[model samples]
Target: MVAENSTPHLHSAVEPRQTFRRALDMAARAAMPSLFVMFCAILLSAPFGIPGQAQLQFGIAMCTVWFWAYSRPRSMPALAVFLCGLVVEIFSFGPPGTVLLSLLVIYGVAHHWRYGLSRLGFIAGWLIFSIFAVLASFFQWALVCLHAVALLSPAPGLFQAALTIGIYPSLTALFVWGRRTFANPDQA
Candidate 1:
């Protein structure tokens, strides 16, 4: 209370509580992208109106996670992508190792071809990967058919594949917009 003539020290007078609040804000911002991804997967996978439709839609989560890795390869490490895919596989009732293997393979291919993929811009790259995802799904289905005595039908599976491809571009666009608007600068 003795600053009548002397210049006031603005930052020096700031309370520790304000600094703590600012830190919390920064931390929350940094965490939002991962939180969003987790939320999207859980929400989309939750038991819904149609089970077959739900199964098909689950691929969108995998697509989003893969696209994030593709778009920001330097930040989203291979290990993280693999781990995330493993978690997805556990939640998804498909072949034990198939989804995880496919995801990693997709990630690797996407990474190797990223320079060209990036040059094609967002939607084009997304469509390319969507085609790859459908092909990979069909390959996995073929393996399942070979192993199972009952024989898995390809018709429903192919329909699911087509549905996934049809929805992929729009979902990828949503993720791209989210990444641009909500992702942390440092996280990417």
Candidate 2:
């Protein structure tokens, strides 16, 4: 009762290779967010020694996580966020968990609003990020102060939030390009 020219056998023979390809594609997709965080960590560790570089480094790092979480929650998993935190601890010479905690807060906020934000467009997204950045940065400042047993100056943290909010549009475009270039066709 089957058609003689049916290509079901051809598809069956190709299934294993297709399955392997899909596995690799999924892996690469997962890696893209981690790759961005790793790159930021490298920047944090680099001896550029520029003033306020730490602020810039952490800002970009947190924004990278938030960006992916907001845009593609599946790509920025909790495990990857944790690894990014570990990377920040190793690279930034800060008390452990400082950067990680701040990033987690950002990820949580972004993920929570991901569905609504995706439809709301850039201004609204940027506005929401502004408020969240301030709160998250303040929390990070308090933690660092508590860990050091002295009230730390919060200027750097404030600067970081400002810089992140300022640069998000450009960075979002770059992240979009990255996803387009590296993401699997199915996801695209």
Candidate 3:
């Protein structure tokens, strides 16, 4: 538990500059994991002569969003998610606003249900993520259909959702390690 005595500096109005600096430091520390995931999405989405490379990157992006939101809501703030979504959209070459909207929806749902899922095991988390995957895919498919001015087939989205679900367990374990490694000392 955090000691009350350790936070006295935050209450002192006389040291406003120092308080701001400390707060900035705290924000940077909190953002590291999410930022790393964003960087990975950008790097992995590039053409690397591998089949299904985009699909892999897409799975990673989705899994990262879900894992961070479910495990560390405070660190995975809405602003970060929004910005990451923008970068992801550019990298994935998706319809404008689609990625941002999807990320926001997933983050919102996970943040709201954090407490409810806190006591559940890995299977429950996986199930929740599966549901979000389907919804997010549908949202993207609808966006694509509207953008193309035609009713598009849902096969691509369905394939992506399946791929995401298939890779989630590995990604979750990796993020769990990342959280432990990069987490604040107190949290660790």
Candidate 4:
């Protein structure tokens, strides 16, 4: 009877090892594909003109990253997303908080919907992102109106806001598809 009880303990000990081994295997399977996707993101983002289209470019990156966040919330850590946004902001011409705030807001929205990522998940995400972008643009325009930077009309900013909304859903779909098909078999 003591040996039978001890056998159960031994089995429990062995079970965790099996679970750990499976997790390691899954992680190893995921690694190469994740690296490839990261490479593609950097490669595509690197050559784009910065200042002239910085806002639009940032929007595109935000959409892309948000899509990825939905796809693999566990894999793409928040700090990495923030750092990516930081790099884009520094290289592009923008006020420091612009990308950071936008990315942070998008991250929050995406994480909130982490469990429901689907074929139309990109569309849903874009709607949430559009709301944040509108608010951010409005605040920035208000600052400009108040001469926080320079007095400016809100019209052009509104136009850009509309454009961001228009483009985000499709761009998100593209990025989401790229992540799904290439990121890993399980994720796919």
For all candidates, what are the clash counts?
A: 0, 0, 0, 0
lDDT of each: 0.65, 0.78, 0.78, 0.62
Candidate 2 residue lDDT tens string, 28-112? 7768778777877877688887876777667777778888888888888888888887887788866567788888888888888
Mark the regions of model 2 whose C-alpha exceeds 4 Å error after superposition. 1-22, 184-188
**After superposing candidate 1, which stretches have Cα over 4 Å from the reference?**
1-37, 51-54, 121-123, 186-188
Point out the worst 10-residue segment of candidate 3 by lDDT.
179-188
TM-scores for candidates 1 onward, in order = 0.71, 0.81, 0.79, 0.63
User: How would you encode candidate 4's per-residue C-alpha lDDT over 105-163 as one tens digit per residue?
Assistant: 77777777777645554456567678877876786577556656567778866866776
Clashing residue pairs for model 2: none
Cα lDDT of candidate 4 equals: 0.62
Q: Relative to the unseen true structure, what is the C-alpha lDDT of residue 73 in candidate 1, on a scale of 0 to 100?
A: 69
Best of the two (1, 3) by TM-score: 3
Q: List the residue pairs that clash in candidate 1.
A: none
Ranking by TM-score: 2, 3, 1, 4
Poorly placed runs, candidate 3 (over 4 Å): 1-29, 185-188
